[model samples]
Target: MRWTWIDRFVRLEPGRRATAVKNLSWAEDYFADHFPGYPVMPAPLILEGLAQTGGILVGHVHQYRKNVILAKMTARFHAEAHPGQQITYTVELLDLNEAGARVRGTATVHDKLLAEADIMFAHVGPEQLPAELADPQFVFSGELAHLLRQAESVISASSSSPPSAVTS
Candidate 1:
């Protein structure tokens, strides 16, 4: 089963950038095992959320025709995110090409930086992998597809509305 780390997309500018949000709560399963009294959001999960945001941005550039995989990432954490906080992941496309794409991402809560990451995503064609692993829909299927649709809906709704009616 695939778990979606991000809750929803707040903004998506295809080929340029993407912004997504994940709200942490004490009800999460990880919080139970992470710490009994002081539950902190796991660092890796935070990175995963950022990667998902960046990966969606990269895949959107190719119209989700290629499977975008996280190749490498370097991240630094400035503060711990707690259960009641909302994490906003903003990723900017640094570079893009046929082989791969690179993005710079930041996780923030209430305008304060919690973490930052530089992520690289590689695009792999069906022919480049084993048959079992080469499902064309592998990357953009299921939950991930749902997130993309939500992003498109937000983008479409915003574009059709007046500037004064739009609020971020």
Candidate 2:
């Protein structure tokens, strides 16, 4: 499915990090039977969201090349995210190399921490996985690429803006 989760939640923050937003709503498909009256976003899915966000960051750091897969994660869920909440997931790169990279991230609803994780990934060549899995060009092209490029452009312009001169 090309992991539409990334497009649905993630926003690249140019040279700093990537921030993803997940809007929980009663209309979500999973809410039908997910605790019926007391529903919450599943912890596993929240981890998946973190992984996707960090994966996108690693992918961009590699200039959209290489197949990157989550190798490890130490994640904790501190609070339940309920319907009508806007969860902001942010990932910051801790280190990067030819092999892969490490990222630290947190998911929050307003000031309440929903989850946090330290994610690690392995960067492999296109031959390391299924043709579909390894080809990022195919995965990110079309609409997703257009949106990401737009985000990237906006980040670039924002970064290039000069600091205002202070009154002497």
Candidate 3:
């Protein structure tokens, strides 16, 4: 099964940055096995969210023609995130080239920092893979591809809507 770590993309800027969110819930399967009563979101999952956010940003740069794979990541967690909290992941492109791309990301809950990471994604070409695994759409197929469409819709909707009036 394909698991999407992010709920939705709030902002996406090709070759620049991306922002996405995930709402934690008690119903998540991991909570049942991860410490039972004191359900805390796994650190790896949090990192995955960041990577997904960054990965999408990198993929969008090439219009998803290239396979963007998470090659390396270094992260630090400052606090635990629990069910009912919302995690906001923001990633900025630090560097990008034919080889790959690097992103600096952060996860925050209600404006408080939860984790930060530096993630690297490798762009794999069809020729680099074995013939059996040389599907051009291998990485960005199905759910992951759907996410890009969803992000575009969100961006369109927000752009078309009138801005809300500010109140003192």
Q: Model 2, residue 74: what's the lDDT?
A: 92
Tens digits of per-residue lDDT for model 2 on 1-168?
434443344456543577877777898777777878888887887888778777777777556666667899998879998889888888887777778778899989888998999999888665565666644445346556764565464354443332232101
Candidate no. 2 TM-score: 0.78
Residue lDDT tens for model 1, 39-99 = 9998999999999999998887767888999999999999999999999999988888788
What is the alpha-carbon lDDT of model 2 when measured against the actual structure? Answer: 0.70
Give per-residue lDDT, candidate 2, residue 141. 60
Give the Å shift of residue 41 in candidate 3. 0.5
lDDT of 3 by residue, 10-32 (tens): 88765667899999999999999
Q: Least lDDT summed over 10 consecutive residues: which range in candidate 2?
A: 159-168
Of 2 and 3, the candidate ahead on TM-score is 3
Residue 43 of model 1, lDDT score = 93
Tell me model 1's lDDT, rounded to 2 decimals. Answer: 0.86
Deviation (Å) of 140 in candidate 1: 0.8
